[model samples]
Target: MAGTHGIHVHGDVEGSQVVVGDHNVVINAALGSSVSVRSEGPPPTRRRTRPAGRALPDRAPQLLGRDRELAALERWLGQGYPVQVYGPPGTGKSVLLRRYAADAATSGRDVVYLPAAGVPAEDLVQELFHACYETENYKPEPARVRRLMGSVRALLVIDDFQGSTAELAELMDAAPGCDVLLATAERHTWDEGRALRLEGLQEEPALALFGEELRRPLRDEEYEAARRLVTAVRGHPLTLVQAAADTTFEVDEDARVTGLANGLSDAASVLLRLLDALSPLPLSAKLLPILAGGVDKAAITELTSLALIGSSGTGYRTTGRVAHLVAERTGPARDAAKLAPALTAWAAATTATRHDIAAEAPVVCHVLAAAAHARDHAAVCALARTTAPALARSLRWGAWHQVLDLGAAAARALGSAADEAYFRQEEEVRKRALGVVALATAGGALAAGGVIGHIAGTAGHGGAAAGKTGFAAAASNPAAITAAVAALVVGGVFAGLATAGDGQPRARPTPSGQVTSLAATGTRPPDPISTAPRPLTRPPSPSRTSPRPPTKATAPPSPTLITSSPPTDPGQGPVSCPLAGGTLTLGAPAGGEATDDYAWQAFKECDDERTLTVDKTDPDHAAFGVTPTSCPKTAHPGQYIPASGPCVYTVRFHPPQSAEPGTQYQAHVIMRDDWGRLSMKVSVYGTVSAASTAGPSSTGPVVTGAACVCSPVRMPRRTQRF
Candidate 1:
């Protein structure tokens, strides 16, 4: 028979209404039409009710540790708004939502509770319509549905909302004014809707729940253990409740719980299997390996939709939880261990090329290392070999240097001829790589120098020479060349060792008969180097002239010269001479005069054989003169004068002079300052004359006067300036 809107019925069609105590039956005659049946089997009868204590309504158990959830639910109900309680499975979310709905209904608020699990999209809508609308003759027209929802302040509670169809998601979006209370195993994201995450009970409340259930306070250690179990299971309410039930509490010693909360994955696995048995499509075999290979939450969600696995989280974890559960049931520790080895093998089998080798090598090595940690030596070796030859070579080097502790045996196992070849090829490439580096370095140096030279307006030839010499030295030393090559190879290899092989060799060094000279013939001579000069010996004195005698009209020469008494022994002190007239009237010298003085004396003594001469003069005197008077009694005193005296007297004795320029000499002179403050002066002058002539042709008489005088013989002017 055909129903309204061309919906066909194969068996029977009943009017949309059904009474509680009626025989409900119908027969259809034609498509798009319905017939009603009048008749009966025994009149419908109500089943016998058990005594009040014997049976209870099939409502969810009383919610524990859900005060916050209930308050939130009541607030939403009062506002006539929808609420979704989302959390991982076993979080007491469904029970809490139900209790809230019941409470709201008791407060005279309209509330409908529906289980969304296994409900078809159409049936779910129908149920919502039936629960909220009071009329028995109602059809689900969109406008009527809207009008009914708009007229009432009602809360619709949906349990297991994640199991609903996409159409339900649409219905939720369309129902603007209707309030909804939803409980889900996972969080839902709906536009303009709020999702309240229902987490597991906190420590205190959870413990209280246990205390209330068990009729005793939980021991400290047992409470701690429960916390750990809860954390491990991510605090799913069902698991904690089960664990609380299974726990044994004692005084002093904490309660001990086993299994359910302790091994969440295992417990969840049991739940998943039950779900799978009920589900129309069983999880796929291929999916298990993928999930076992460390599938994340998003991947798991997609897998769940495909009936590959079951999950709970908002993202990938829908299938992820199921996979974890499966892993737990299969031996969590063993399953976790197996993952690394499987991943290692997969990576090894897949990554074979050298391109992206550095990138791929690290990933492969990580897998291998993880496998090694899991004690899967075969997998480690398999993955290690999959590493590019260049990378393997580096690994060997690392092993040799003790940087990495790939066991010696394993290192030896990994050492292959291919790796050696790859290393040698790398070294060869490095050697060739230097040519470009050398050229670039040379270019950079030249450019830098050119800039500097331009700024200074002078090029440094020496710098150019140094650069050339460096280039030559680098080319000549095999060790230096090898080191450069090694550095480049190592650097580039780490940067990324391309898959391409080394190119063909270029020109080789050859001996040439025609020699090209590098001699710097036209180069400018280097600057002259000089040493500091030594100090001079005798500096020449300035030429001087004697002052002329003063006329009568001129002031009389000052007679202030006062001579000290001569020594008793003539040789002991400076020779003394009496002035020709009273005191000598000396005047200042005409030109630059010598500022210092010295005195001299000569002595003769009669000895047994003959008169022996004892000359006593200033140690610095040039020469000394002596005159002896005829001895009246055969012992006469010698008349002496200073060697450089103004008076020249005949003398029988002579002394030799040294050839050195600065030798000492002594002389006498009458000196005076024109200014009377320093009147007529009497002093001895020491002259260190240039080396004296050995023989004199003629000698002029020495002038003796009070006026100052220079040496008698006039020589060309010899005034010397410093």
Candidate 2:
């Protein structure tokens, strides 16, 4: 029975769950929860959760090609649902979450944005306390945390969450009036809340972002090359940015890979080279130790955090880009040599559990395809046969056939006609036994992931072999169930996670065409990242060990939040800080043909500064485009600017003759610095405060965006993604 504290279990094999809370429950599932373990300690203490990493960035990535996404986020926000923005690494999840948090903060809702790529939950909680109460040392006692959470509305934007989903829900429930919007790169079924999977930017947006990378529009002659380049890399933002510098703009995947891998650390370079052998298939983190060999876990995590590897804790997959770069090396340390044994060892280990053997089934076949290139055909042949049981039980009749076909070819290569005929006959026997496709459609693929294994497990569970050979009995975690790697493989969630033998993203089931998301219950397109199989240093372990379903936090579960805005005068909202450097800012200038010289001190320390110069002032509305005086874009011609600078610039604001008395004119500045770095944008607007009832004067637009509606953080005309 589910109670006030949210400690309940939703047993699928049993009767209905009695949810005695605010959430609506569904039958046969915990629709709102998973296996929850209540804290067994005494009354909560005032123990502070230690904070980690840096605070939220002042700016957000440009929101490129996300109008529909913006509308979806706002609509979901209004309805009060937990929002999940998911996509592969580098799809700009962090940027979106930061924007959401900044907006909420501007609207007077307490906001805490945490970028959790490699951060632990405890560290995040520490960040929460420090951000919320504006105190770093205070221990967050349950009741105290509860008061702040319930007394006011709040939002927690956890970007790239790698912690426990249940734990996250618990923290939210504990904090009564708080809501959460988490972004992740892994794939999971979320039965509740709203899930938005951010894909690669569409064609136009891709080109637009590429131009932005170039900091100029594509030339007419260069347009076709850019188009072919964009299409060649499938509109992946980061790839485009890296490729922009390659003037030749080759229309080849290998060329794009070479370009993207231009500058990488030696450790990263080594890991990528080794991991390339595992391409086209995402290997589970559990197998990292074997695959990565002696590669340090820190390097793996660093790469993961940088999106050069897996999307954090979701296992690792090699991108074709890594393949080309690694291919250039004649390494003394050969990672490819280690590939065969690792696959074989992992395959052998699965035999003990007989669960999700198909997890690595497709991967085995794909690896075999690279036998000649891999310099290890003999082992690959063995690998295919070794995982045969997994292939059949997981309903990979096609893979099973491929395995036999590979074996027959191996025999033929050895000039053994008898062995080849024997292999062919065995293939026919298997085909006859498994018959045609065991299932079709995405849903069927997921279900068939464990069809045969489940049957065997059931037999060992309730039949004559109860508690013996079945997966559940053999599994170390008694309550856990293996999710279908085969199912995902079939539906294209992992279609190109592993590349074909030739080192390119391969559409599985059929090694052709551009990879796409599951048309049904599926995953994202072919976006790959990886690290050596490194040991997990944080919670929210991979789905293999604990496959928790999606659900809302149960009731009365208070944890803690860090920051909130103090009371503000009515109509005088909190002011936002200036947007981060290197983007455009909008200003709605207001005033009549007034030539007012407002002090530009507000933007003194807005961004990284050394020496500032005005690049260009193109007003959306007019010259100095803002309605009134323009926000300062640059300091007086020449001066060294420091981190905290009193960089000042005098600008003439030619407000249109029809300017209004209290209109807020928006000004976008492309602030260029002498340093070899991208320019920063600060949206500055002039504001003439009106009397607040009987008050003398009121707080108005400043260097910040909030009171300024907060620069760069706004829904924005558009943002960059990558």
Candidate 3:
């Protein structure tokens, strides 16, 4: 079916196309003999959105009471600086920037916005290039991109930005003249331009969000109680919206989420528990009933009224606080068997495309993993057959690999060697394709084979750690594979890789790929719930260090709280499970002078003596050094015998000469062990002030209820599975 084009060469690329300088990088190997691009299979598709090049993405959520924040963002962009917006979980970080991006686009500004979850940090530059240029898979040379961006001066907005300092540096390099906005739940200490901390809605905005969610103004008696309820949770928007479910809602200061479910109507109760069962997936309304074995219409309506779940694009999902609390209190629907048949049937249906089920893909992956765990061989086979190819085509290579591995494992359980062989062959094709992607992203630094993580003895997606799922072997004559890979790399395939953030990549599989084998399965770290946040003594300051030229944007942070009582481990089924726990807290403040040192300690959270690394310094103009201190390792530096004894580290911050008066300076450092994230961030005010020419000062909304101890919270990092 492949043919060389005439003068036109009519190159067809399976994915979208981006014209490069004389070289056409083809996606999906649809390249003709003449270097070009084209769709590989007869049918090629994309998400159900407007054409991708610089178009405003369609799924912007409605926001209320954010006028000031929006204005501040507007001012920051006006300053032509990069902005970093940080906050706690579920506080509408994505919503704010998304709203801003849409409005700016309507006004005809060149705006590019992308969500950064589930993507490898290394790929940030590639993704940024794609967004700015509306290119399918290519990242033009950096110098070229910078020059283009300088002239374009477009606003670049990246949501859920969790990249490292280096990743960010690369992105800034590519957009020197543009305003960049980065949002994240956790705080990055590096000097990002114009840092804005987005707090929960104040009383006014809270009421607005509540009234809108309720579809009415507060009743005569409802207003006071709503105020108290908002106060109880510090006006966090997600909580306020959930409370709006009952107009006469009282503050549930002591929230017993499990007990609340019992009070719902019969239909509502079932729906509530079902949603809790699918804890993390964003299930669409269309698929919810199917997954719940045909839930009643009233049940969904009831839950919506309760605000137990909210819309996320085409799907619905529970956010931070609700998700954790529910997962803590409930279990999946009575049995996996009850849901298996229905899910499998849905997957077997041929009506949906990648766009149709994009939001539901993660939900599908979760259930597929469950089916394999339940030994529902037939169901696993059915789901994999439909989902794998679609996943691969959408660049969800990680999930596709796992789905195939799960399918092959199911085939083995069903005693079908043929299916297993078929999956392995497809994997070889995937590995070679990945080599091209990895090499292109790496700018040809990596050996082709290094890109394939599932090589024989490495970690396998569906199988054990013994590497049962990778291609059988590297081709004996490497020339053909190398040349082909080289062609794909040179002819240009998608230059960047895209992993599904919500795609629910399969649980890390074991040697046998048996879901039932707990030891064999690898699970991602759970985000612990913080129902009662411990207040810090000092007023919570929203972190904002102005970047020299660019700025960024926000996400919600959940610093772990040590529960007085152990949370009922849902997996234990009625048993109160005791678990080992601790907290990481302050050591000593950094000395005022450039070389003056400071310290922080880990009470009981330190795991095997980890070293501290300076993640970033505000303004990055100053010098800061961090190292594991011999003393002050036991607790907060203040609590120890000597301020620096037995706990954290002795570090120092020296502001860069360019650091000006009236502007504050800060240093951020982080550490991680087996349990969760550990970090220390400190601030030192410039001694002399009054002059304000060099640095950025807050022009955004005043952070309401900003008194929060910005703690080192759980930071989620992704592992490449393909």
Candidate 4:
């Protein structure tokens, strides 16, 4: 069967006409008339209705809040200052624009309004041209647009704008003769216009809005409940109205979320989970695809329409209420798997303190935080390992500490011996960096203000180490100890522990062959290799002008050894198990002795002479024997093998007994070196499927967890290869 279709090239077609027909192109042609042609395809998808540029009512919709903003806007527009009003979704940007446009129309001025969002730039220009000229059809030439706009005294309202500043600037430039107003979910500071950031309603007005929507005056008790509802939704007007209509202003959060979810596309629904997971950090439309695992941009647009998320000056944020809803609906496993790769990429990217880089802080923080919350240890450690150097270089001490803390927690949670040790090494590096600065400043006899340590401790970790010998001790009596140490170091006096407030010398022996003090105490040094942190004391304040170096006859001094205790509770099973293909999962173990590979090396090049040794006496070591009983050997017992440089260790799981159908097992790996540093325990999980009735090799979804730490290992500089 041959199919024929009709197509129309009608010059007389009005504004944006659609021609639809199939297989029967019987062209109806008449002189000085139209010829209809048909085309064949599926039915046209439903198109979004254009927003009506309707006139405002004589009595405007009860705008209970926004009085101040409304007054300010009127004054600005009256004074002829072009204004751009922006806020998060459902904050009533479009409603305000409509009211303003209606007011302009009532004043007898020509009014041109266009819903600019979801429309192309060229199409927007054309719409503007048509509105300005009072014509349905026109070419969108910039010169013609300017000419049409200049000939009329008009108010131009471009609502729901989404684009760069330059695009808005271009629109403003074209409509030179009119007062232009833009409403958007983004922030733009136009050179020729003012930007007004809209926030939620005030308390009284928010309550008033609720009452008005409910069509009744509230009693005192109802008013209190309404106030609670308003506060819960952060005074967003739309939410209050919906609550008033549906729940009588009592505020049903679940109902509210479901209402918002109504009419949302599937992609938008999935994005809600990602946005909720990242609610802890600032989000932007630009980062939507990256964070949502490459969702289409149209889905983001739909999310905006649904008002599931809102925007600030530079980025987006899901409201606390919406975030809660999303959190309840989303699974931790889904979030971890989706966000792990994106976070890894984000941490690895080179960034700066410049404007562009600064804008990315929210996304970065959100990824790390979400991964941590999801108990995605592999993702957290991956981010930490990659971003450590950059964080150090940028001096983002607080962020660096956050990474370290999260990484350490994840390592501990995973029960990966090597992973835990890796985090400890990183922590040591951080401690050294912080301690060196404090110690060097004190030694230099410089003015060590409390702000340095105080701010670092406050911002980094709530003064977590304040009680001990590291930053906390330094911050506690910075003046006496730091000042005295600086005086001594300035006088070329090197090693000695500080004195306590009670005047007792709190000390520990220094390492071998290292001079503790210029003066020798003749006392035998303590054990040189205890990794435990020892208490430090404050030193006596020295006279400013009378600094003297200590002689060789002084008593032996204790060198400070700052360290923290290894975790005791290896941590409950990771918050969520990695799905197949995510980090921390090796494919289903082949029987009881399955081997799992890792992505990063487990070695660190350090100055310590202690050799890496498997403590066979340790239960973990005995359970998962090291492969080949030596370094540089491959294909030994379990999946893990140690390489020459720092490389990820593979683990081989040896279940006590296997071959059981419909059972799950945990593979635990714990390794340690002779220096007392313990590796994070790595746990890989797998399940034995029910025996298939068919073939012996056939199995159900073999549960798999990749125990690999997905980070590239970088060897430390200046290390001697063994």
Candidate 5:
């Protein structure tokens, strides 16, 4: 039986029996082989063949915009790994899988394509098993099916596999080593596979598809309309294919298509109905508006299960199919309106929980009057007041302000005067909040004196405060007043001693025993008598005198000469003397060391001589008077070097005053080194004022000098020696 190519048998044959029944003959019987002639049953009915011109439906490579997906399928096929392709409908998952399978078959690889959609689970398993074992007109048993699956180097493509049930799991488990490609409208629950999500075709691909299928170039306007339609439909291949087939553009004599491509609304309706049929739940007329609120991924997935929406990866959108069906049967506008009251009621009831109500209501209300008519005062107010603060705190200032305005308006409309009063009271709370901020700022200022400049500049210069009024007001509170007093005390302690009359202009004393004359050559001089006097001094000059005196017969009148010389130093004791020159330069020994502490005490001397006296009478003055009269080799105590001036003086002996001595008759001078070490004192002296000698000269020396002469000398411009 296995060797015979063409023969018929009517009865069961045992061994090699050749049996002829009614219209036949029997031949050789044994030999384990026999040539049997048997009457054949009536010829089987033949299938009618197509005419010469007709051919079998040729399924060409259908893949579009799926090159990457095909490559992935090839990789999985090579590895004998099962792969599941998933995405929203119209992404061409099935087409891609089938095309890959065809390509593999053309490359000498065996492939079996199965459509799982609507097929019974048992039947699908059976068909898969048959494809695995049977080949080239051979029948396969269950054992052969199992063995074939283990060894076969072929791929199986399952299209629309989302409908597969648990029964199909056995077939999957049996073909663990065999390659399987699954195409589904949604991701599957299969455990032993990787899922590749497919995105919708892009605009360029869609346009190419349109051009290829339509066999004509789309006009500019038609192309634009197509693009809009495709984008709105998320470039869904199925929808684009339908739209491309249905739409046509032609240029008339006026260069316009007779009718423009349909609007999105029209196309959306058709897609909508298809989606409805594919949905898990029967979408009632009630839920359409809610789904349309925003056709995002989450919304689409939700509505898809409810039979109200569909989407592709370009993004979820309303369907023209559903829109049109409703329009054709239930008056487009009227059917759409039916959703209004229900959506409005839903919105109103759910407003308290829906954070997005404000954003959604306006659009929903446009389609459904009930949305506008529904009262949501509480919701609006809650959004405005509570949410606004949260937004502000989150630093969404613009959004916070918008929400506040919205809430304020809602509150005004829905709330009574009492509500307004409550808000006004809340304003006080806000002010108090501002006060807290101000207090914090103040505390910072107190911690760091740098903020003092800002505060003083504001208060003293009358600039506006940095913080809000409440903060400023809080800073001005009684607590702040005490703080201010404490700060003032602290500042005063740091500022040092401030003398009351120190900055005032007053008369200065002159050196004691100082004689000044307005008639003296050079600049006129000032009085040197007052306690705080200011005196002027001049350069030394030799006295003018005649060289001879007549002596022969008559006695020459006694010559009287006014002689001027440097003041005399009276040893270690304070000395008093009249000044001759307008200037006096006290020269101390180069390195003379003295412990003499001295302070000048000016007193009115002879008035006619316009003389004043400086005496170191007290112990303090004596202590300051011990400077060496002659130059010495050692360092001398510092002296008060008075401005160049003629002055009278009284000398006394005392120890040098310590540093920071005030009102001590002795001099106190301290010098610091760059390294902060103390250095030996240099000679220094105090100045004294004298009476003016600018007017008509009197008998005695006129005192005060001209302003320029009495004033302190202008420092000379020193040349740069380098």
Candidate 6:
């Protein structure tokens, strides 16, 4: 005989779970679902209850791409470290934990699955206590909980763990011999614990999984389309599933994007909007809050969960296909404008080296391309202008040109004529300077460079990498030289001087190699009186007669007191600087060096002390091999001229570092006086031939080019009162 009574529990609990205590009890329940109670006399054995709704091990769905994670979890459990599975959303952390829980139950371990999204700590402990002790009321203590958990060999699986990490830590610590597995998108909870970070599946597996979802084998052609679909969703399982399910495996790009975004929460939706607005650029995590307009970690986590954003080591970026979708859905609004100043500031403030620039090129290009496409004129222009210097420093002339073109197009779109013209002019100058491509024949090449310069010339400084003639030879063919000169005139390319400032009035070098002072053109001289030299005069001739008898040798006359220019013989036309006549061949099998002692001495004709400089105003300064150590060292080698006043220089020419077997380098030697005046440009040439095999130190014979004559450059005869 049995008496029936009702037992009531006050607090809310899962309807599927039933509590049983330590006593002999006969209860009729379904075969797969039951709670068996035994008497305390049994050797410390406890009753194991399976919730009515819990799926049997065989009935539970299996997870893909989690084999490694499952094995890792088993290893961690054996080693007694509480394991947490963490990653961006849709990475399958929750599914993995659930799978583990079901497996543990099948293995005879007491399994308690708790969804901890919003549950408080004390409540969680009380619930676990009631579930364990089968009592209505009990004061939960960590020690008691630890002892009780050990007896049952309980395994606690917390899903979507969105509670305080401290609470989670407490539970983990108090569980003693019990194993705790947590699944969370947050990283902090796993900081000191063993964590398995879930990422997307590999290509082959992802496609296979997609095929499995479709319940069919993929055709060969479908493999490529499937691969595109998988890549477009970044190999995310949930995204792949949704994408596959929505379009009947057709994978319409827009529909796939919309489907992926269909069920996002408010925070996630906002994040998606922001990411779309900032399309084509990856931003550092530190700038997220500011650039995303006060978006928080939760929002970013939400987006990451959806696999809309990818995490880089330094920052976050929208996935490529997702970024394209975002750009398509959203126009270039305020967010695009906002990205400009932020990125520009970063480029300016950071000491980003060339390597850094190269590394960040993909991200930079993405942002710039989006901006250009959207016609965000202000943003495009600002970024292009700000990053120009760095690009030039890195020798990225191609990228630099693109930046300028972007600015120009943006300016035109905005109908800002002045801005458009400015950018256009800058572009023209860049093209002229760096874009010079000339044939190797010496007489022809110079003429070719001159003609091209005239056609595309602009008054701006040429960059170091500009005007490169990689290989050239001025063969002693007169017809070739004549043809080259004719080509120069016809090609409309003439080596012209770059203007001093941004089209501002300044002293300029004339074709005759004279400096027309800005003062003469109603502007003040660019240099201060302390630095600029007085006008030059032809020094009087030295007496042909013998020097005064050496009774008391008078100190040598001051260089200024000595007459500078001697009477020109009817034979030689005009006198030239000593550097004019020297030849330097770089890459020659035999190395060579040239020194010009007369570089400084030639300026001693003036009465007042003055500075002499090299005429670096020509855009070809770098092409002509004028550097501080070898020639006049100044900031603007083109404009400032080389060699300080009254200084000597030597140029050592050997094969360029790791020179090719048959390469030639050629350029002119140029110098200037301090009055912003230019001396005649001298020609220097070099060629690299094969090395001699007889000895490592021995080099092959020198291959000479056609002889280049240095004609005396005429200077305006002027007398200075200073």
Worst 10-residue lDDT window for candidate 3 reads: 513-522
TM-score of each: 0.31, 0.35, 0.50, 0.32, 0.28, 0.31
**lDDT (C-alpha) at residue 609 in model 5:** 16
Per-residue C-alpha lDDT of model 3 across residues 1-722, encoded as one tens digit per residue: 12211111211234443222112223342232123334332122122222133344464566676777676676545544356666665667777787887776776666666555434343445545544454343434343454444444566787777555444545565665556777766544322244566666667777778888788878888888777776666667777666665543656533635544544676666666666556545566788767776758776666666667655554555565554454345444444335656766765577666534433555666777778878888878777766665554444544666777888888888887777776665565555444433332331112222212122223222322222222223223345335534443323221222221221111321221011100100122211111111111111212122322322322122233222222134332111000111111121222323332222222122222353455432233244555565533333211101122223354444444554543343333444332333322223223323333222122211110000111122111111111
Q: What is the C-alpha RMSD of each candidate to the true structure, in Å?
A: 50.9, 25.6, 19.6, 31.6, 46.9, 35.1
Per-candidate clash tally = 19, 57, 59, 38, 90, 29
After superposition, candidate 5 runs with Cα above 4 Å error: 1-58, 132-145, 248-722
Candidate 1's residue-wise lDDT over 250-358, tens digit each? 2111222223224344334433443333232222232334325433445443334332243321111222233333434433233222444444444344442323333
Please, what are the lDDT tens digits per residue for candidate 2 over residues 1-722? 22213223342224333221112111122221133423222222232232223445555556777777766666544434456776554456666677766665565555556655434453355445445544321333333344443433456677667544433433443444445678766533221245666656678988998897777889999999888776665666655654554444666656555544554567776776666555534655656666666647776664554344553224665433444354355244444434666777777773433234544454566566666345454665566556654443333344566777776777667666765665565565453222211111122222222222223333222421321234233233322322332322223111211221222222212311122221111011111101101111111212111222322321111112112222233342222222222112222233322232222222322233332333232222253522223334333222222122123333333445455545444444434222222223444344333223221112222222110111111111111111
RMSD to native, candidate 1: 50.9
Model 1 segments more than 4 A misplaced = 1-64, 134-139, 163-166, 173-177, 213-215, 248-276, 279-722
Once all C-alphas are superposed, what RMSD does model 4 give against the true structure? 31.6
Which regions in candidate 6 have their CA more than 4 angstroms from the true location? 1-60, 189-192, 248-255, 259-722
TM-score quality measure for candidate 3: 0.50
Whichever of 5 and 6 has more TM-score, that candidate is 6
Which 10 residues in a row give candidate 2 its minimum summed lDDT? Answer: 529-538
When 2 and 6 are scored with lDDT, the better candidate is 6
